[model samples]
Target: MEIDELTPAEARIWRAFARGDYVDFRTGPDDDPADGAAWGPERTVRARVLRTLLLDGPRASGEIPSLDLSGARITGGLHLQYATVELAVRLKNCWFEEVPRLYAARLWEINLSESVLPGLIAHAVRVDGVLRMTRARFTGLVRLAGAEVTGSLYLEGARIDAPDAEGPVLQLNQAALGADLWAPGLRARGPVRLTGASVTGTVHLKDAVLDAPGRTALDAQSLVVGSSVTAGCLDARGTLDFRGARVPGTLELTHARLSCPGGIALRATSCVIGELWLFGDGRIEGALRLRRARIDSLSLDPDLVPDEVYLNDLTYGALVPQHPAERRLQMLERDGDGYVPYSYEQLTAAYRRNGDDDAARRVQLAKLRRHRRTLPWYGRVWGRLQDAAVGYGFRPLRAGAWLLSLLAAGSVVYALAPPPALKPGEAPDFSPVFYTLDLLLPIISFGQETAFAPEGPYQWLSYALVLMGWLLASTVIAGVTRSVSRP
Candidate 1:
């Protein structure tokens, strides 16, 4: 574009760019501009100048000058709402008096690293390249709601402090990113919301520190990530909600420290992930809710003991624990109220699939024992009796042993006792073993007990023998039925 075609402000900005001057309010001849500041004319680039450059600059030659307003104090906020920019915007080390607005705008790329701004409002904006804000500091909310980035979104070493404690410091709700969302070393004083956001690559938040006590420190509900969501070494002070999120890769929190006493520290209800890792030095002070979550594999640290954990309906294909089976069993048992039979069943199946039948049986036995403990007093008593007599109907041999012992005792009693008195012209014929068997069998009959009745103490002994026979028979029958009917 020719110089005459530009307005006075645009021309002035063009000339200042030609002279490599930094656009600032105090760039006048009388004023002493800071060292390393641009050598522009004694005039700041007004918002009109910026608008004209972005709207009218030639796109073919890429002749748009780089906005090197580093260390310059922008008097007014930059408003690019609904505008399109073909050039990159670099405002490194700059200070903004007001938050920049880029609502619904399309830009090539943005670089605001090391800048101190009130905040940013870039709702529905489309960036063809990265939205770099590394080492930047924001004093207010940085809203990127519904924005789409074709490249990664970098916020490493950034510090965000929202004015309102209840509001999020960085809001990316419903945003779509073509690449990863890197936020390592981030320090946010308020919650970071990424609700319903979709990322094609990983969401890395390693070594980040978030402080939003009694509220969500990081909320990524319904988020869909193509790769993993890793937060190793993260220190979060409030709830980290990942409800309904889907990740094809793992959701790892290897060395994170979460604290939200009496509240949910991590709530991942209904989430589906390839793998879940809460191993290593991760510690959660509050409850960790994983209700209805579906994971292909889960890895938990042996020593990790959250204050409270809920695992209702939480299904996993395998449990990858470094600890022994006993330790893992203990961990599951510690969930007291949250423990469910299906969880134990799932573990049993996994172990069985791995050809660890012993472990699987042990898990089954533990489950039964735990369930028995949870039963009422009467149920428990019955369970104990079944266990001792028939091993909950699993040990048929035990029932047979009790029957044998009763038969032997009855035989000895009858053999040692005096023979029954003979009637007139009747010969005394008594076989103690046969007599015991006949009485105990109930179906068969021999003349001993019926024809020759016991006298005195032997009569009481006969009644005792009949009662023992009935009890033994009933227990054996019940055990057989239970064993056959059990799944």
Candidate 2:
């Protein structure tokens, strides 16, 4: 298009593009023209004219020319599919009639700060510099799948509402970023996806509001981040998934309100992170998935625990706040996914890492008690015997007390009523202590059990003592063997 073919507003923007100057076309206060429909021709620049200026404008003499327009209404679609533009595009406080299409377009910096647009489609678009959409509002979908951003992408204070869209409201699946995804106050009505995305720096979602009730609000599966991904104070209504994600730094969710009710609230299965902080009195309304996740430091608050959790094979180096062993044990039991031994072992290990061997032993005992519930009736009965006599081999003092109590009772009863000698002609005189010891010892012999045979009630008591001895011995052996082999 020639200079004469451009409109008066387009002519002015074209002149400014050549000279590399910023143009403010608003005649009055900076107010949005309702849907960009009420704006006059003086403030409306057709998208074709801007595209021509970016692609076929006059050559620059010294500095690189840029297209920076503010407070102007953009009419028609600014389609730059597969095109190469070597300049910056800054359209601050502007309103668009049609969404900008930059599919597979290679460009420099692009800033749409405080602009109101229908949506954006820049999937597979390669950007050399920063892509900032600070405080911008989108009423439709913002697709940026497979985009390669050389610099950081900032979406602070931006609002993207496309609750009725077929896909995510802010689609950024598989995007590769050279720097951080710094969105501090982002608000999205529909789901915001970042599946398979890679960021070299941190992902800041602080105080962001993501609402997609009965669905996934943030689907960030397989996302790899170099630094921390902080979602502190975030208010999400649906699941915030991080399945198979790898974050080398902390994933902090302090003071976050995550609500998904009978569904999964925050799923981070198989995530490998430095620290996972879910503390600070946050309200977690649904289940949390930490199945097979490995973290260095897992900081949790007792009051912030969710009811249903799947923590099988989830290992952590340490648990912060150093809650009492009993409190931490309750957290492990909340794994409503049934009895997973690995969860107990992992929690015990976390306690042991801090030199709390006593707490670790308690956890082991609790594990046995929990396992008993999943066994058959006979197994459970045997388990109860071990617990009563030996505390599942975790408390040696309790085992000693049980042994002493049984020994004292047997010795007194045998001393009070001595059993008759079996072979009176050859049998030696039987000592009451020796007889009681012989009946109680399952393996060791004191030569008195065979020498004397009690008749009637005394015989019944002897048999009962012998059976009790065998049961106690077997249960103790099994519990001790398990504890020793596990450690």
Candidate 3:
């Protein structure tokens, strides 16, 4: 407990916190113009060595560089529960707006490397060891980056970890991730940089087994894991180099076993993800490129990408495919058969880019009869109605339902025939149209010229029983719309 020994005016506030020197820590101590706790050279000796270890409770390890306590104004909660201090508490260029609060402050193998931690609120901070924040400037909302304890939130060439572990990584690179930043099992040997840091949120690291034998590379560049992150699972099997990372949401990678080299590139260009399950104990041999990813919904969730993986320039949703077979089930297993056949030539190339080719070929024949049997799908619905009756020439609803069901069944057989009395003048018959017009009756009704008609005979059998009940209800509604328009 002897390291707090500096005094030539506290070594100029510890070399202005080793040179980050921001200065104006809210003004006023009036340089001993007679007490107000006398402050001067830019502030931060970590608030007077943490207010002399919270009023002298645990200051023996090295007594903190000899007490001048730099601009002095540190506040409460410096409770170092187990007390065993060794030294290396160099709050680099620290200027925390008066060390507001930090509960279980157990900085075990401490080294807070290069700090300038703006408005920190160390909620559950129990770094049982290393917390080296490489190149810090962490303004406000650090919210413990979703505190879970165990250690290893390191940040290699770090610029930002949490401006809003859920709402604001602003400063361009937006943000969003309410929780789950759990560090897997965390035995971190090295390799964990938020490369070129612009992280909005989600850097989960599920099952985190970073053994980094000699550490080749593990950068998470241009990182903008936004879209308010819902689940979280970036399991890095070793060399994860998210080329230009931008995962908008659900990127489970199911059993995430990526051994990386050229694997997981999600080819960023504002890559907007949401539903990308990529199933089973993962293994991206080299290229999972997703060229310019924006997949709104592509869940291969069943086993997690083993329907025989392929991927490239992917286009499953979020619109962009004009029909080269929409191309996104990109080989989730082909030859050995991890099942494909969502036919109608891939639902007519995803309904010609989602216009709805006969409802995407009836949901690709109802998901290919739920698992195939040589999908006849009614002979592909009579070959798509005979290719819409011969290459989309058009049938006008089957020639207007076969000429309105043969004119409503020949007007119900000529209104049940047998009433041909225009005989009084005789010339009216005109010999039934000269010589037997083949017993003519396809329909020729012209009988309403009555100055005194309806003379009797039950009024012509009540006008032929109301014209045979209106041609039998128009031939039973055109034969029930041609039996529900079959296919």
TM-score for every candidate vs. truth?
0.79, 0.92, 0.32
Ranking by TM-score: 2, 1, 3
lDDT of 1 by residue, 92-176 (tens): 7666667899999999889888777889999999999999999888888999999999999999999998737447889999999
Residue 133 miss distance in model 2 (angstroms) = 0.5
Say which prediction, candidate 2 or candidate 3, comes out ahead on TM-score: 2
Better of 2 and 3 by lDDT: 2
RMSD of 2: 2.6
lDDT of candidate 3 at residue 307, scale 0 to 100: 31
Better structure of 1 and 2 per TM-score: 2
**What lDDT would candidate 3 get against the real structure?**
0.41
Those runs of model 1 whose alpha carbons end farther than 4 Å from true positions after fitting are 1-52, 56-64, 305-307, 322-326, 329-339, 373-378, 394-487
> Which number leads on TM-score?
2
For residues 286-321, write the lDDT of model 3, one tens digit per residue: 334443455676654332333323333445553332
